[model samples]
Target: MKNMNQLITIAFFVLSTNFFAQDKQDQQNEIVAVWITADETKIEIYKEGNVYLGNPINSKGERNTKIEVLNLEYTNGKWVGKIYSKKRGKLLDVECLVEGDNLLLEVTTRFISTELEWNRAKS
Candidate 1:
């Protein structure tokens, strides 16, 4: 009887650990949805084929803006995104974040500063 109790305890512990691990992975793999203020276009960004692709999520439009992501850096418990736009045929530098149901996108060029808020979508 004691051996059976020990085995059950071990099984519970292992299952709990796996559940937590999967939850963490789900959080990390979440996609950040964005809406560009320049043209009111909705874009969904996902890491696909080992690269980042931004597509019009709900509405379709002629969009030619995409920055290849090299790495994702986190700071102060916030998700920070960095991308290279020179290779994507754009002259914009972006550093943005996703917090709860809000996204703050910062774009800068030689002499332009654009900051916009992106409300998250309910899924």
Candidate 2:
């Protein structure tokens, strides 16, 4: 009886850990998809190695010639990275969150900050 109980306890611990790990993976993967910007631009977010990168897509669903606009990594329950600002001609600090069907990006500078929302693109 003692041996059987110990086996059951070990099995429960392993199963619970696996479930929690899978949940965390699902949350991290939620941001990996095509998202549409407020101004109607499409940005595709993909994982390259350990980091996530995003680039704009043209009208015909092709990647734009410009450099990647987003470079982010998941850390401590949030996505932290840099976003390239075409108007400002520099990379700015950014933090991202995925909420339901929307991905929210918060861009910050020394004296200013702004939030932008991007919706997940339909398949």
Candidate 3:
């Protein structure tokens, strides 16, 4: 009976350790970017920490919006979030994922897609 209890404890600890390690790994691989599309212009996003701040830097070189970060979702290997644009006064959702050495981004509501090479910024 004592032996069985010890085995259960050990198994629990091992599983907990692995789960946490995987969570840390997933956080480390998150991505942030300034996405550009033909119609809407730009979107600024941060995947990890579930943070997002979207604003159009320049719409045809003219200011057109006030933007703020909204609640974003962060999955182990996926990012999906929505941003509120002051110019349009609306929210737009986007999805992103890592594929090998490239980053995949798609704004389904807008039907726009882009693939950008991953460049690690000096931390």
Candidate 4:
């Protein structure tokens, strides 16, 4: 009876550890449904292959913009991406994080770095 109790305890410990590990991974792997920039440009981002892509959509009855966000990669708690500006005809480095109900974005160029906050558009 004592040996059986020990075996059950060991099994329970292993199972509980695995459960917690899976839960932590799930939290890290969560994807934001949508994010809206301060300028009221709403975008839907999703993972495709190994990178993420974003598409603009209408917000508050405003016309949907044709701009697109591309080449986002997540690693080590930071998101690395690029935003192409049609006006400048260049791509800028963008880093982002999902903090609470806001998406914090940092756009960095050769001469300057700008940080912007995007509100979560969906749960």
Best by TM-score: 2
Per-residue lDDT over 2-109 for candidate 4, one digit per residue giving the tens place of the 0 to 100 score = 999999999999999999989865544454457787878777777767667777776464424466664587777767889876557898998887778887888888
Report the candidate with higher TM-score, 2 versus 3: 2
Each prediction's TM-score versus the true structure: 0.53, 0.92, 0.44, 0.70
lDDT by residue (1-123, candidate 2, tens digit) is 999999999999999999999999888878999999998989999888889999999879987747799999999888999999988999999999999889999999987999999999999
Error of 1 at 2 (Å): 2.6
lDDT of 3 by residue, 22-104 (tens): 98766644555455543545544454354544444464643234545333666655767764544567876756665543445
Local accuracy by lDDT, each model: 0.56, 0.92, 0.55, 0.74
lDDT of 2: 0.92
Q: In model 3, which residue pairs have backbone atoms overlapping below 3 Å?
A: none
Q: Which ten residues in a row are the worst by lDDT in model 1?
A: 67-76
Error of 4 at 59 (Å): 7.2
TM-score of 3: 0.44
Q: Rank the candidates by TM-score, best first.
A: 2, 4, 1, 3
Task: Candidate 3: list runs displaced more than 4 Å.
Answer: 1-29, 32-66, 69-71, 83-90, 110-123
Candidate 1 residue-pair clash tally = 0
Misplaced by over 4 Å in model 1 are: 32-39, 49-77, 84-96, 105-116, 121-123
